[model samples]
Target: MAITMTKGQTGLTGNAAIAVAMKQINPDVCAAYPITPSTTVIEDFSSYVADGKVTTELITVESEHSAMSACIGASAAGARVMTATSAQGLALMWEMLYIASGMRLPIILTNVNRALSAPINIHCDHSDSMGARDSGWIQIYSETVQEGYDNLIQAVRIAEDERVLLPAMVCLDGFITSHAIENIALLEDEDVKKFVGEYRAQNSLLDTDKPSTYGAMTLPDVYINFKHQQSQAIARAKEVVIEVGKEFGKKFGRTYALFDAYRLEDAEAAIVILNSAAGTTKVAVDELRKQGKLVGALRPRLFRPFPFKEIADALSHVKAIAVLDRADSMSGFGGPVFNEVRSALYDADKRPKVMSRIYGLGGRDYKVKDALGVFNELQKVLETGKVETLQKYITI
Candidate 1:
């Protein structure tokens, strides 16, 4: 379907863009608590609710856990629900995070990426979102404020699809993208409302004629099957994500993919990373291309289901590749993204010699030079046909 959006550019931070998206969608309920970086999302959204800008029910919850619990309840009761959190706030809602997805509530959450506490630091990192990677939620990472807003709009459709009624996380780097202002064009409210459409749940808990049960205890025999069903929902969601992305692009002129591939075709070496770092990597890629180098980058937008085959296919032709992780797995093997990328290429017909590089923990600066260094390392690995270290840290 073609959508006509009014063209108007505005400068907004990632948090403000998210709030703008929420105001456009005007979900039935928003249950959220305040946290650094992410706090602005709920704060601005609350102001919209107060000024009569939107008709959403703004639930000022006491804690992140309660916020998620309330979202699950509202979703179960057939209301379109949303919430936002970061770092420890997301960690606190871990248990309920699984419950929301396990119940197939189709709740949408905006997770501002932050480092999980040990030293109690509040900075941008992938630990929080990566930690919840296995919680049955579809994850979409954003590289800029524009993508953050675009992802949030598409997230609603992806989550509420009848074939894939699962929860989704629209994640953006804390402070970096969340607080940094950038120019972005917003779609008309009527067009956004028309594109998002009205939420139509298949089996709502509020339906009186056809009663249903949620969260019922299952025996050992059926538990595995339920888990498999949840797995299948996400598997189906991959296709829905692509379809929604295509429609969104056709309407908004911005195309999205499971992973954004930059100059990857016919490249002999590449670097794989995620989030805002991809923006920096692109600058490096462009510079290297001028020297007739076959260097490229692959930034994964969808992380949960992994898009194993698609990723393997994209990198199958490259001779060497570097996978950069913003957070460490500490599993002695490699970072989370590294492990997954390696596993995806394990059985490829023409697999690339892959290396892992961990960078940007606790908001460390990752510059274009750092990305160029990784590309240079990949070029070296390609020329030597030998892997020096399987995993190492990239110092900026």
Candidate 2:
């Protein structure tokens, strides 16, 4: 699908756009705690709360763990729940994250991507969300303020679907997209209300008439079986995400998919990336195409429950590829996205040569020049039919 654009409202920061989405959603409950880059999301929503603009019951908590805990409880009670956090805040909620997903809470969370601390950085990176990649939450990365807003709105339908009752994290790069003002258009309040509809959880804890239990301990005999079901549910979400995207487009005119591909078809070289960097890389791709180079870009929007086969097919024709990651894997091998993309191509009929590159750690600049350099390297790989270095750092 081509990149869909909707323009109307302008000069809204990513955080503010997300807040507007939340206000329009008017969920039953909101569990909030403050963290940089994402703090204003809550602050702006709180003003709406103060003015009685939304009927949501806002619960102020002490920590991110407590925040997620409250979301689990509210969701179990049949209330549509949501929250927001970043980096270390997400780390603190790690334990609770499992309980939310494992129990099928279908809560919506907006995680502003930030670098995890040891050397104390408060900037953009994928380490926070990457660490929880296996935590069973559906992950969607956004490339701009518009996507961040759009994704969160769609996430409500995706997570709440009966076939895929799992929590979802709509992640936007912290201090980058999160702080940058950009063009965006919001759907009408009534339209958003009609689209999401009213959340009717099948098994509400508050229904004393039909009593139910949550987070009950299971013995090893049946534990693996329960996990298998959870795994299958996430596996089914890939289709639901696409379905919702289409419906959203029919209504709002901006459709999304598993991943967004630009100038990739019939290209000789391509760059595989995620989130906001795709915008910069696309500029590089346009420049190279003008120079008579066959190059392209593919940005994976959905991260968890990765579309391995779909991605493999999309990239089958390329002669060589460069997969860029915002965070280092620290395994002395390559970044997380590189490993997964390489593995995906293992079964392809014509597997292209793929290499890994890490960049933009702690919010380092990834300009068009840096992307041009990567594309230049890909051109060399196409000429020699060899990848000199399997992995390296870029844009330092």
Highest TM-score among the candidates is held by which one?
Answer: 2
lDDT of 2 by residue, 51-129 (tens): 9999999999999999999999999999999999999999999999999999988999999999999888899999999
* Cα lDDT, model 2, residue 101: 91
Q: For candidate 2, what is the TM-score?
A: 0.97
| Over 4 Å off, model 2 | 1-7
On a 0 to 1 TM-score scale, where does candidate 1 land against the true structure? 0.96
- Among all windows of 10 consecutive residues in model 1, the one with the lowest summed lDDT is 1-10
Query: How much is 336 displaced in model 1, in angstroms?
Result: 0.9
Cα lDDT tens digits, model 1, 1-396, are 754444588889999999999999999999999998799999999999999999999898899999999999899989999999999999999999999999998899999999998978788999999999999999999999999999999999999999999999999999999999888888899989998999977677888898999779999989999889999999999999999999999998998889999999989988899999999999999999999999899999999778999999999999999999999998987789999998999989987899999999989999999999988888879879988888998865
What value of lDDT does candidate 1 attain over all alpha carbons?
0.93
